[model samples]
Every structure is written in structure tokens, then in C-alpha cells.
Target: MSLLEKQPNTSSEFEVDSQRRHEQDAHLDSKLRTLRLLDGARAGATLLALLMGLAVLGTTGHALQAYNTSRFDASAGGAAWLSMWPDNGAFDVKPTVALVVGASLVVLSNVIALTSHHRFVRARLAAAHTPLTFSAPFVGLVVAIVAVILFYVANQSATADTLLSWSCRWRFLNTASPAPQFASLCRASHAGVDLAILLIPVEFAAFVLAGFELKLQRYTAAYTHARKTPSPVLA
Candidate 1:
């Protein structure tokens, strides 16, 4: 009777151990899935920033070209009222170039980070907790600031008493109107500015999301490490 009871007890102990291991595996799977979702979100935000940056570059390039090609017909009577020269400051492409460079760096950094996610998490797990030294957030911040400057420049160019404003005002006028000469250029500049404004928020979100993802990774690593570590032995 004693031997039969002992055999049943041994089988019950094995069943409990198997159940514990299954639970642990399930928990680990859940954590991995969560991490994947976060990484995906970070990637999405970064890609959007890249697209917006490219768009700004295109619109600004067009504006710059249009401005250079614009000519004034002093023969027209309204030529006295219309300025042939567009606002040089407003149409400058240098700022747009800077914005694009920053955005490209952000995308490249994100790619590198995604590829190294597993290794990064593993390192975090093995090492003591430390602050992240990633530069994505800082780059994103700079990009956002540049975008703001672009927006301000564009807004001022569009609204101020500049040639761009003049062109827009007379855009619907007759074909003989001198405004037509500057209209297209001004429109491109306005479009570029609008895109830059949009970029501000997008860039901010991208960096913010990246920062959040880092925190999540750190937390996950620490949790995993804690679980793997054995408890202190009792005296």
C-alpha cells in the first residue's frame, strides 16, 4: 500500500514540473510578441519622418528652380507694381537640405537598431541597468527644430508683402498678368513649408516612440534576467 502511494506522489510531482515549464514558455512568448509590436511602431514612425523629409526636399527644389527661372517683363504696365525678384531668403534650399540630412540619418539609425534589437536586448539582460546612449532622439529633435524654422520662413514668405504673396494675390488674374511668372514658384515654396510644418510633429513622434521603445526593451531585459537568476539558497 505504501509503495503504491509513493509512486502516485512521484507522478504528481513530475506533472507539476511540466506544467511550470509550459507556463514559463508561454510567458516568454508573450514578452517577445510585445517587443515586436513596439519595434514595429517605432519603425513606422521613423519611415513617416523619412517620407515627409523627402517631400520637403522635392517641393523646395521645385521652388528653387522656379525662382531661378522667373523673369520680369518690364514691358507690362503692372510690372511697376510687381517685383520680378522673389524673396531670396524665403526660397533658400539650404535649410531644406539640412532637414533632409537629419531625417536620412534618423532612418539609417533606425535600420541599424532594428537589426541589432536581439543583441541589444541580450546585452541589457546581461549587464547592469544603464541609460541608453542612442542618438535617434537627439537627431529627431534637431530635425523637428529645422522643420519649425522652415515653416516659419515659409509662412512669412507666403503672408508677408513679398513677391510670393504678390504672385498668389494675382494668380487668378489674366494671362498677361506678371503674377503668373512668380505664381508657380511661390506655390511650390508654400507647399514645401506646409510639408515642413507637418514634419515637426512627425519627427517629434518618431523620437518619442523610439525613446519609449528603449525603455520597454530595458524593462523586458531586466525582467528576463531576474527570472533567469536563481534565488539565494536558504541557510
Candidate 2:
């Protein structure tokens, strides 16, 4: 028989070949979708990380400058301690407002990322969605959560007594001092800086986790899509 001649068994062979090709095409499409989502997530995460890193530096610098240059004073009856900023202080600082701005930037960056994800899903998966598509909305919810958590964490470092909270505790714990001491009274240089430093890592971890969650959503969508697509039909 000629190469193109129809054989009795050729119909079955052709169906199998077509099915395999269909599966391969479906899988390739899934991978491409996944890669696009992953790219968006990575870019957003990078920007968020940069903003948070700047926040860390700003908090540390504010704390250190206040410590080094601001005048630490106490009430006559020793009721309270205060760090009074000098207009001429070596480190001019605005921890609360600055941190708020930083937090806003973080929130903005995450919002843009999440919006991108949503648009992709609505445009691509809305019609032929699987149970996995429910995850489309759920995909970047973690980023919003991270933004809120980071905002609060940043707030801690910006608060007035944040450093003093740990400073007094440290003096009471490690020093011979039996009484709780205000930052001015204790003169502990490290003070709340340690807590601020510790939170930096926690902030970093939150962003990292958010990125992973985005990836998880993308991979799951791809898998579900591949599984749902029908194989090629036999003639």
C-alpha cells in the first residue's frame, strides 16, 4: 500500500496521535499562562520589598537620630520622660508621618499587583472557569493582608513609647536596676532600636510569603486548566 493509503487500523492510531498532540498543546498553553502571572507577581513583590526596605532604613535612622540628638528630659516628680526634638538636632526626624507615608506606598504597590492579577483572570478565565477560578479573587488577598500587617508593624516602630517599651524592660531584666526606667532615666542606648530591627525581618518574611501565595495561585490555575481541557476527538 502507498504511504497515504487508509489502513483498517489507521483510524485508531490517528486518534491516539491527535489526543497526544492536544494534550501537549493544552499543557503548553497552561505553562504560558502561569509564566505571565508569575512575572507580574515577581515584579510587584520586588517593588513592595524595595518600599519596605526604605521603611526599615527610615525607622532606624529616625530612632537613632532622636537618640543621639534629641534632648531627653524628665518631669520634676519623675513622672514621665520625653525626647524633645531640637529644630537644630543632628537628625531631624518624623517617624510617625514618615512611616505612614511608607505604609501608604506599600499599600499602593500591592494594590496595583492585585489589580493586575484580577484583570488577567477576568479576561482569561471568567468564561471557562473551574473551581480553581474562584481562586482568582483569592489569589492576591494575601498581599492585602501583608500590607495591613506591615502597616501595623511599621506603626510600632513609629510610636513614641515603642523604643522605651523595650528599653525599660531591658534595663530591668539585665541591669542591677530594680525599677522600671524611662528612656531618659535609663540612658540605655539600644532602647527600642532592637525591636525595630527585629520587625524588619518579619516585614521581609510577610512580603516573601505573599509572593509565594501568588505563585501558588498561578500554578493551581494552570493545573486545573490542563485537567479540564478535553482531548481531541476521533474522526
Candidate 3:
């Protein structure tokens, strides 16, 4: 072919290549935008879950304290620690059920947050970006799981047994004053109380971590999009 004729063909091929590249870049940009939106949504959902879990934990703590107080009053007259009292109105049943239900709900919330976070990571990877390694939602999930287990154990066991000894006040009542036994039980119960208290901060930390992750994800996605797109010049 003559040089002049070959020139047109070469220019046409170059145009086709440039057009294809532009189209590919546009496609990538669209996908990245979709991912950014998804990540934002996942992050929001995670935050909501964390908050709900915290509320549940707080309720569980309050319920447990109420139960312990009622138990102490019932055992005051040298009554058997295990002796059922009507003063509390089915105390064991109500607190136990509330705590178990609360734990279950907390666990469910963590599971939901975890699943959303996993999806967020996958979306980031698909967009050719490094997924977040550590996040608040993940930390919150871990703390929530631990809290659930601790609360379950605390609620199921009768705190009174640890605090007071079962005895017939008329027989061998002086053998061992319930005082020492009650003290020891109180100490043990306090340990669980301390654990429940610790969860508050842990849960808060998890929520903070999730918030940071959400912000970072949003920032990174915005920066990436900005870098990929060409700036339009004013004529």
C-alpha cells in the first residue's frame, strides 16, 4: 500500500484503541462508584448493629443487678438460700428469660454486622483495592460474643447459693454462720459483675473502630475515583 493510504488505516486503528481504553476506564469508574455506595451502606448497617448490641448489654446488666438485690433481701432472715420466695414474683424466671433473649439478640446483631463487613471487604477486593484488615464492626462482634456467654452464665446460676448456705435454722445453725459463705458468694458474683462492666468499654471501642473503618473506606473510594477521572478544562 502507498504511504498515504497506509497512514489513514494506522490513524483509524489508533482511534479504535483509544476509544476502547476510554470505554474500559468508564466501566471501571462505574463499578468503583457502585462499590463505594455498597461500602457506605454496609458501614451504616454495622454501626446500627453495634448500637443495638450495646443497648442489650446494658439491659442485661440492669436486670442482673435487680435479681441480685432481690435475692439478698429474701435470704436476710436465715432462710435457705435456695428457698423460693414470692417477694420477687417469679424472679428467677423473668431475669433468666430476659438475659437469654438479650444475649441471643446481641449475637444475631453481631452476625449481621459481620456478614455485612465481609461483603464490604469482598467488594473492595473486586474493585482492585486492598480490603480493610481491621474494622470496628469486627471488634464489636468479638466483644458481643464474649458478653453473651458471660451474661448467660451469670443469669442461669442462682447467686444466693454462692452468698448464703442452706440450713435448718433450728438445727446446726451455729455450725457456720452464713456470713462467711455469703461473703464468698458475693465475691464470686462480683467477679461476674466486673466482667459485665468491662464489656461496656469493649463494645464502645468496637463501635469506634467501625466508625473509623467507614470513614476510611469512604475517603479511599473518593480518592480513587478522583484519580481515575480526567479533569475537564473550561474553554
Candidate 4:
């Protein structure tokens, strides 16, 4: 064959090979991007779970402290107790606020993580020739259950002492000790603490299960993307 004639054929073959290489590179890049997104989603899920666990622990601790404080006041000279009534109300207020704020943070973190996981799953399904489903709704259901338990604990009723005692009257310059009212309040506090102890474990389990669901979604996306791409490294 003439050199000029053969040169055209060689150039055509080289162009085809270059195009194939470019397509393969693009596919590999896409796979890498999907995997990175999955990793990020999984990390976010883990962080959310940890935050929820900590919040549960904090709330439980607060409940226990309140219970102990109430019992102490009931046993002491009623009004003489540091935890009694108006004297140290601020101390109780601070812990309650902390519990609320921590719970709020946990809910926000989980929601963000769930949204990120859904995005990652959708992206993978679009790029790959596979059927994948993400179950964020189940996680939301579990969160709702936890919220209900928290609400129940927060709204329980309390009664305080209102009896008349000479010491309480002298201390507060009043005619009553309010010991009966204080005792009732302490009983309510103890009830709340018991309820909290029962609910915290359930909440912790829900958090862990949600984390597992997120991790499963992440791994599924990573695996499906690797399978579709013609790359041995990812495979």
C-alpha cells in the first residue's frame, strides 16, 4: 500500500482508540465522584447518631439529677433544702435548657444526614443500570417515636408541698412550710426520672438503627457504581 494511503488508516485507528480511552476515563471519574459522596454521607450519618446518643445521655442525666434534688429537698427541712422552690430554681432551669438544646441539635443533624443520603442514592441510581431504593421514611418514623417519648416525659404533672411548719414560716417569714406540696412535686420528679430511664434506651436503639440504614444506603451506592464502571480498581 502507498504510505499516504496507509497513513490515513493509522490516524483513524488512533482516533478511535483515543476516544475509547476518554470515555473510560470519564466513567472512572464518575465512579470516584459517587464513592466520595457515599463516604461523606456515611460520615454524616455516623456523626448524627453520635449526637443523638449524647443528647439522650444528657437528658437522662438531667432527669436523674432533678429526681435526686427533689428527694433531697423532701427529706431536708422542706424549705431549708437548697433544691427547694425559689432558692435554686435557676440551677434546674440551666440543665433543662441544655437538654432541650442538645435534643434540637440531634434532630437537625439526623435530618441533614438523611437528606444527603437520599441525594447520594439518587445520583447513583441515575448513573448506574441498577434498581436501588433508599428508605429514609423508616428513619423518620423512628425519630417520630423518640419525639413522642420525649414529649411524654416533658409534660408529666408535678405537685409541690404546701403544709404549714414553724421553721418554714420563720425562714420564709410566712405561715406555712409547704412540705406537702414539695413532697408531691418530688414524687412527680421521680416519676419523670423513671420514665426517662425507660425511654433513653429505646431512643438510643433508634439512633443506631438509623445510622445502620444510612450506612447500608452508602455502601449499596458505592458497590453499584463500581459494578457498572469498567474499572478494575473500583471492582
How well is each residue in 168-199 modelled by candidate 4, as lDDT tens digits?
23343322343324333334434433433443
By TM-score, is 1 or 2 better? 1
- Please report the candidate that would top lDDT against the real structure: 1
**TM-score, each model?**
0.62, 0.35, 0.42, 0.37
Model 1, 1-235: lDDT tens digits are: 8999899889999999899878887987887787778667766766676676667667666654454444434434446534544354544345444544554554455444444445666475534212222355456557667655754565464434443455566566544443344556567656766776777677677667667667777777887898799989899
Give residue 216's error in model 2 in angstroms: 9.4
In model 4, residue pairs whose N, Cα or C atoms come closer than 3 Å (at least 3 residues apart or on different chains), thus clashing, are 159-185, 160-181, 160-182, 161-178, 161-180, 161-181, 161-182, 162-178, 162-181, 163-178
Off by over 4 Å in 4: 1-7, 72-144, 149-235
Query: Each candidate: what lDDT?
Result: 0.59, 0.45, 0.50, 0.46
Encode model 3's per-residue lDDT on 44-156: one tens digit a residue: 55555555555554544444454466457547665564353333332333433433354455556555555545667567564433233234345555655555465455455
Worst 10 residues of 1 by lDDT: 125-134
**Model 2, 1-235: lDDT tens per residue?**
7655767469879999899879877876776666566555555544444455355445444544444432432223342233232233322234333433444454454444445446676577655332332232233334334534553464365334433334444444432222234344234323223333443454355355445655665676676677689879899
| Cα deviation of 23, candidate 2, in Å | 1.6
Model 2 pairs in collision: 163-192
Residue 146 of model 1 has an lDDT of 64
Please tell me which model should have the higher TM-score, number 2 or number 4: 4
Greater TM-score among 2 and 3 belongs to: 3
